[model samples]
Target: MIRRINDIVAKHIQGNLITYFFVILFFMTGISSGAFMSKALTDFQNKELIVYLKNFFSIVDSKAINNLAILKQSLLNNFQTGIIIWILGVTVIGIPLILLIIGLRGFIIGFTVGFFVKQMGFKGVIFSLVSILPQNILIVPCTVFIGVLGISFSLMLIKNKTRKNTRYSIVNQFFLYSTIIAMIHIIIVVGCLIEAYISPFFIKYISTYM
Candidate 1:
């Protein structure tokens, strides 16, 4: 089973190497930009962020987090992102938007980690690991995959548009695209559950000691 899965992943990667390369490069560029932005924060803004982080830690230590609320919000945010990417895949003109979404996700993550580490050093790194890393482990990959697929699909549509008679059935291609995206949605759901349920416990525990 593991080998089968590995083979499947390898084949997919081989098929989309160029797309993945561009998508990943774009994501990394966003991350770099976000990290730069974090460093560019004014002293007042830095202090404000520090205060906010401390307040958040206090809340976690006090066990005041509403898990259900977190879950609902996480689901809403993740699902909306997924749906947008899925829709954009179908709209060839939305290629830029799809890349922007992916880049924005990377930027957010980069800023968060950059700010944490820059302000708090090692402790901040530990805090980020517990609080931010869990869900993002899945989320980051999902965003990248979605970007690659969206771009690839959009390119395919563009190619088809220029053709006198397309070789593949658009309906069948769309169904496959939709199906893959639906599976990604399931992964996103799991990631949200981890964010809402599992990460909190780790954050709460670390908050007390940190």
Candidate 2:
């Protein structure tokens, strides 16, 4: 069973290399642009985030003060959505659709972080890391999984491998990929919760001393 899972993972990685490259490239470009932009808007963005945080802290109940669980669950929900998009992309017209879906996801991350870093200066970069890194660590794997599954299906189409139980192959692939995606979602949520409640206080203290 381990070997079988490994084989599937290896195949998925090899197949999706091209798509991964494009996605990474686009994401990096966005990050670079966002960093520059963040520098331009540092004061504004910092002020806004600070104000927002203060407001959020004010009315939030003591129970809600510990929002780690909610943040974690939100990350998991996001990953599950990615999994759904991947499954949909496997259908007859789903290949390009998957690419579009992944691309958009990457774009949003790039844009937000880029704008953030650009606006905050070095502190902005630090803030971005504190804010997005935890969730992103979870998201990257999910995105890669989607890319691999999409590529695998595309390969099947190109090679005309639709014979001798093609339906079974499709079903198996979907099941396997979905399971992995779900697992990733769970892991990410757990990480997010920790980061949300715990990291902020530590980060804020550290920033003050620095």
The TM-score measured for candidate 1 stands at 0.93
Q: What is the lDDT of candidate 1?
A: 0.86
- The lDDT per prediction is 0.86, 0.61
Best by lDDT: 1
lDDT, candidate 1, at 2: 100
What tens digits encode model 1's per-residue C-alpha lDDT throughout 1-210?
Answer: 999988987998899999898888878888888888999999999999989988888777876779899999999998888888888988879888987888888788889889988998898899889889999899889878877888888888998987775655877888898888889888888899999999998888888876
Residue 147 accuracy (lDDT) in model 1? 77
Give the Cα RMSD of candidate 1. 1.7
Q: lDDT value for candidate 2?
A: 0.61
Which runs of model 1 end up more than 4 angstroms from their true locations? 1-5
Candidates' TM-scores? 0.93, 0.66
Q: In candidate 2, list every pair of residues with a backbone clash.
A: 34-114, 35-118, 38-118, 38-119, 39-118, 39-119, 42-119
lDDT of 2 by residue, 12-46 (tens): 66866786776566445545655555455567676
